[model samples]
Target: MDQKQVRQRIEEIIDNNAIGILSTVENNKPYARYMTFLNKDKTMYTPTSRETYKVEEIDKNSNVHVLLGYQGEGFGDEYVEVTGTASIRDDKELIEDLWTDELDNWFDGKDDPKLIFLEIKPEYVRLMNGRGEPPHSLDL
Candidate 1:
């Protein structure tokens, strides 16, 4: 596929998938956890508490990796690998836009003091198992 087509496909994958693994560097070691992600354009957002370890890790090192889009049905499952920088965001507009009822499981509500969002801006993105083609990078 051409660059534009490939980008659209990748964005489709991002939009279709809600769960992913978010990896952060902690104590010079890799720490990974499952996170529910939301994408706007090509950027990804995952909400979390301000006091969480991942937030602390991102504060020290902005670099992060995300594994998303895989639906574990069979050998040909497609997935996206993301290399990016993460930052904390608490903008009221963004919070309102990305808010979901499921997040109530974590925070008291959108107004909760602990509520925060991690915004990931991709420096690199790769699409794997792309309809029998070899894995390739998507230029940002």
Candidate 2:
């Protein structure tokens, strides 16, 4: 697929799948965890607490990886591998915008002092195992 087409596909996958694996580097090793994400204009955001280990790791290294979009029905299931830079976002407006009731399990509310987000801006993204096609890169 061309860049535009690949981008559209990438966006579709991200928009469709809110659950993704977010990986960060910790002590020169990879640490990954499932996260609920929200995106706007191809950038990803995941809510977390300011006290989380991932936040500390991100402070040391901005590079991150995200994998989303596979449904586990086996082969031909398309997925995305996202490589990006992560930065902490504590903006109250952003927190309010991405907030969901489910987050109550973790935070008291959107106004919780510990509430924060990891804003991941894609640097490279690849569409993997797409239907009837080889992998394609959404060149930034």
Best by TM-score: 2
lDDT per residue for candidate 2 within 1-140, as digits (tens), equals: 78888888888999999999999998999999999999987789999999999999999999999999999977889999999999999998888788989999999998899999999999999999976899898878
RMSD of each: 1.2, 1.1
Q: What is the lDDT of candidate 2?
A: 0.93
Question: In candidate 1, what are the lDDT values of residues 1-140, reduced to their tens digit?
Answer: 67787788788888888999999998889999999999987789999999999999999999999999888876668898999999999998999999999999999998998899999999999888866788878978
lDDT of each: 0.91, 0.93
TM-score, cand. 1: 0.94
Model 2, residue 20: distance off in Å is 0.6
Per-candidate TM vs. native? Answer: 0.94, 0.94
Clashes of 1: 0
